[model samples]
Target: MAVSNVPKYHIAMFPWFAMGHMTPLLHLANEIAKRGHTITYFMPRKAQLKLQHLNLYPDLITFHTITIPHIDGLPPGTEIATEIPISLCPLLVETSDLTQDQIELAFRANKPNFVVHDNAHWMPRLAKQLGIKSICYDVVSAATLALVFVPGRNFPKDRPITEEDLSQLPPGYPSSKVVFRGHEIRPLMMITMPMGKNITFYERMVKAKKDSDAIAIRTCEELEGKLCEYMVAQYKKPVLFTGPVLSAEDMKTPLEDRWDKWLGGLNPGSVVYCSFGSEFILEKDQFEELVFGFEVTGLPFLIALKTPRGCATIEEALPEGFEERVKGRGVVYGGWVQQPLILKHPSVGCFVSHCGASSMWESLMSDCQIVLVPQLIDQVLNTRQLAEELEVAVEVKREENGWFTKESLSNAIKSVMDSDSEVGVKVKNNHAKWKEILGKPEFMSGYADRFVQNLHDLVK
Candidate 1:
């Protein structure tokens, strides 16, 4: 790097240890580095290994490895949240909290002008102590944050928060279309519950928002204008967006040969590809029903998900006679495959996803018709953004028990895949409209440039 093009300012970032959180922060880092700014990324040693490929500008961006401190219940090398059960996530948070001193040392050495992070609310306090500004960046959808976690949204402390409370829209919340239902609200119940050393998830997020100099999310005002406004008013701080920080040109690696050969053999826009992102393990009955649902669709399909409980592999969890019926046409893969590439494949026409924030952006940028089956709270909110607000996707109808029937799953797929279906035509048209706007280089890059400028102004 020449002195003439030297980085404008130094910034450091550390998101939660989960790949879901870390990957988005890294994507944002990549965009910032593109504008001749330096970055020091702090993440778990293992996540760095898995995600180093995303560091497109190594000359401008650097990775500093972090090893999670050992805790009693965690295994010898438990470094990330995805490797363990959800119940054990609190332990991971506790371990991450133990690293305040470690991060402070990095701060002292690197001397970043701004510290960008999530989960580590302590980052704000630490940054202030060292004369660095703190930027709290959220990778989750804007709608989710506005509806669920905005200030003044917490239930009264006198009584416990019920499912009813979770289902109700927050006062002055931007949308009623994204409400949680039935057992789907169970995940939100733990938001305020104490985890490590009595620090609740709700409290951490509140502090991160309140204490930071500014807040940022990976979405722009065009798609979520009202929600962004709500954030500014609620938090009473500067809010910024990076406009879906993903680029197809950045991921140069071609899809692996085996997947290429299989998908290539199918007709264009004929295959239904399904993945729930990392860390979701479906229960036994839901897993079997989900695969059975695809079988009923009678479409060429690929499902990338974990084996259900009591099963060692996807093969063992298969219902009897399942293999014989769908051997050539359907694949139940239990391992990680390159998701972004697979969605871009020509043969993949319909994507059945868990409506994760990353998946939502990827699916929108692709030409595929979208189908959502959201499991977590953020996912549920993301589903509404696409299926209800934007009208570019259809969420599979679930029963009152929070489980979808195979028929419902099959119906949603057929509705989107069938050319004559009304629902299919509407989503396809809406999805194509979004795909065009998001794929434009100038639109996405412009947001990134302005975001950096905003930070620059903060320091100046």
Candidate 2:
């Protein structure tokens, strides 16, 4: 098919505030910009800072910051998209309340050839009223999307997870792991993380699914073809997997040099990388368990500690002399670090993660052995699939309080770093193959162009 010679389009790309969502959508916008489309990327100020740090300047892309009028109970500069809790519950409600107004006016004023918005955002409902095209962008995995949209067949819920439960995976895929459509999984889970419980938000998601023009997820069918089929069959929308939209163009400081330095200072494969992405807010007990686990693990690790000031109850959670004993051996930095770089580093042999889709993909693509430290939603399921099913990662044991203790954390870390361990060797080997598959140039850009072409067809 020949490329269209139509006039340039004004496109609005809106993503929910989390790093996982913002990073990929920005990549999509850059691709659209390269195609001569003018993009107005709408997000909050905090999100703007993150984008700016990535060198995505206003001159490069127009940024429309959402302004809330007469909103009480909101701190100043709180834009709903960026400020919503990491849990799907609050995010669904806050984004709906926050994006509804801006979405209405932005679509009306720009008369966009199409409005590309996050599935969590409010554009789907307003698209028809504003006489514009809109598409739901899933920032999570296609396998996850499949799990949510395709309802799980009735299985005896006698146990938390039985062999019968695992056998119901989408067809054409191995039934070794239980995978459901992404939409169907959200409502059933105990939603907790950045903010605790809100059941009403799930109800809104059901309605939003019915109102959208189309849906797209941040994945590739080549990577998850069977699951993608399930999503399309269930949603009855054109669900395109656009692959991971990570620009390979000088993302940050090269990891090789940093890894060499970190290795020169330590033994080979000695350092562990611990990060939970930006969404998890650890409670005091949970924080203590992690720190205690690190102390017990007796391995050099780089941990990102993002506990808010009040959440400094982590000090109380740690074992006595925990920080002092690990001085210079274990490094802990507050706020964010470049995770992909950390994972790709040679010194870092293992990742203890929350299993967010982006981090999971990055870990796989970077050849980093993983130890799953899942918190909520599809993470526990993903952990099971990666560890128990794929044998590419290890799952940390959890307690009844829903937090994995320091003992389990330490043991998992030690096991992964143990060169003699069969599981460790298996993970290392599997990661190499994952990296090889993800490194294919066609996997990145070729599929992306196909996705954009699909969007162009709908608009034209």
Candidate 3:
């Protein structure tokens, strides 16, 4: 706390109000704090509560709460921490001026040398008003940005992903999934390319690509070189391929004694860990597919179901005889799971995920084979890239509806478990590489240092 001992280079981080966004930014902030810089993370108070709920290391960084004005259009009681639909996200932008004012006041009071802003935030405008250098923090990979944005000759004259092109690979695209859960194909990819479309998300990305001082991506060149190159050429900004930002303790081994007690009678690898993140509830038909899938997969499954439909509750969501059929093997929780710990368990050999970047990172970090089941937004694209390009994961189904029959689900799990299969080996290798990449304490520290130094330079 001494004046000289305080060191230099104060930075501010503002991320989208999603757990995926907050997790990495918090990890980065903690890293910067360790390097003797001050970081005041700006976010809604509810987000701060979520961090506290997770028992995050609060002593390492400071939280500057920004009260979100209640917008008329948003549904009642929708906390800022919950997911806002893409259609509603634009309202946040319209209200950007007000958020900007709050941010500027915080800036005037704290005078951050630089600010790292989420891709969705009205960052460039906010930074210009504050006269502080701003960096775009992309929570997803750069390759994804490029693939989504980079226009192709086949691209429609107008529209977002004009035609069905889900099966079509990127130019010199790496090995990505051709099919998922039976013969279902991704219908969303057939639309116009993601970048050229004037949708709010695309416009924000374009603005950030054209005007941001620098862009930081949550991926490494080692894992994705071609995608990184595409981003560099298209964005025309200094691309900082900041490695995946994650904390070691994220994999808190639930007390060995407690975990053992919890699983006292179950066979090892008997429990299926099902979580669809804080958001993303299943529709009725989709929920039924899930019910049958778990039954057909013939594995002991634990499902956490949530949705806008009344199905979010367990008894309401579970089909008749679902519990009776699965019996002791089935445990349904209505809310979130400790994902990091669940993925790391010896019983957890496979992860059914929406392939959000955080979930993907956590699953790979845990060295588990993943069955990707992306629901909305960039997830379909991410799932495609992970399964096809990376070859480490498998897609649950190609349809955007997230509709997979019980038979497909059973086969997907079987394929994932067939230890001798090529895909399975590649998955294991990819998981091993991920473990090697992130498991190194020194390597993680280096990323922390580079991120801090880069921000310091931006401020200077």
Candidate 4:
């Protein structure tokens, strides 16, 4: 690369230890590197291994591993948070805090202009000690962050959040109403406000917000313009929106692969690609119901499910003869697959998702209609935005008490897949509109450029 008038920077990134968190940070790091900056990414050893397939720029991006110090209650070899149950997340946070000394040592040896960290509370304080500017990079939606970080809106500091608290609107955000049901918020509170921890997840988020010089979120104004505007007013900080950060390179997979071959052979707009991400572990009964729902649809479908802990294979968890019953029409994969590639396939018309922010963006870019079946934290919030606000997805209606039935699942799938239906037509049109916006290079790259320019100003 030739020298230019633009100033180059050395930035360090530290994201929470999960694939969902690490992948976005990696994409942002690549974006920054493309502008001729140097990045030193800090991650746990096991998490770093997952990036082996990514075609990162070696000259500009460096991976530095932080050895995870073991906690007593955490299981052996569980270096990453997703490897264990959500109940153990608080211990994972505590273990991440133990890496403070190691991270500080790395900073002292090679100082950078700025450090970017995620929801970890200790990072801003550490960056302050090193006299480097700190930027909080949030991977979740802006609406979720607005509820958590805005002053006086968070849960009471002294007590855990209750069902009543979850139902009401957060303080200071009167215009933003509560959209999550009590059942949806129950699991979210369990993950974020775990018992016996000295610091609650909400408190950690508050600290990170209060200590950072500025904030960077992985979204665009197009999707969450109102909430982003509200967050800027509430926090009184420089809020930068890095729109999507998607690339074709990240979605690449061998076309000749079995999964690709099967998808390619199907008719366009005929298949539903279902995945619940890596962290969600479904109960046997719940898993069976989902499989049966897909079988009832009788449409060509592909599902990628995470193997539950102690389950030797997908077969052990699956209903007897379920695969045989759906043979030639549906295929189930136990482990990971190239999700982006599948979504981009012409045969895939709908994405049956857990409503994760990443999956939402991928579906939008691929012009695939969404069928939301949210499982855990922030997913419910994402579902609300897509199904209610954006009107680009149809959520599966659960029982009055929040339990899902196979009938409801099948109905939701059919609603989105039926092109002649009113809901299906609207969803397809909305998805296409967003896809056109996301396809433009200038629209997405503009956000990254603004982010880097703002960081340059902050450091100067």
Most lDDT-accurate candidate: 1
User: Of the candidates numbered 2 and 3, which has the greater lDDT value?
Assistant: 3
- Cα misplacement distance, residue 393 of candidate 3 (Å): 2.0
**Per-residue lDDT of model 4, residues 1-460, tens digit only:** 2223458989999998888888988889988898899999998989888885563787898999998888799997677877898778778878888888998999998798789998777788888888989998998888777755566654654655555665566645533432566354457565346433587676778678778999889999888777788787877888888888776585555544887788878899899889998888877677888888898998999989987556778889888898789888898888788888888778888899998879878877876879998876577778878887777889898876555888999999898888688999998887777788878878877888878888877866
Highest-TM-score candidate:
1
- True-structure lDDT of candidate 1: 0.87
Against the true structure, what is each candidate's TM-score?
0.96, 0.83, 0.85, 0.94
* Candidate 1 residue pairs in clash (backbone atoms < 3 Å): none
Cα-based lDDT at residue 101, candidate 4: 93
What are the Cα lDDT values of the candidates? 0.87, 0.65, 0.67, 0.80
The full ranking of all candidates by TM-score, starting with the best, is: 1, 4, 3, 2
Per-residue alpha-carbon lDDT of candidate 3 for residues 27-88, written as tens digits (9 for 90 to 100): 87776676667778887777787785443446646888887766677665444545564445
Q: Would you give me the overall lDDT of model 2? A: 0.65
Cand. 3 Cα-lDDT: 0.67
Candidate 2 local lDDT, 61-142, one digit each (tens): 7877775443444555555443434443353445435557766777677677777776543457677777777877877666
Per-residue accuracy of model 1 over 35-126 as CA lDDT, tens digit each: 78899998889898899888889999999987689999888898988898777888888898888888999999889999898857788999
> Could you give the C-alpha RMSD of every candidate to the true structure, in order shown?
2.3, 4.8, 4.5, 2.4
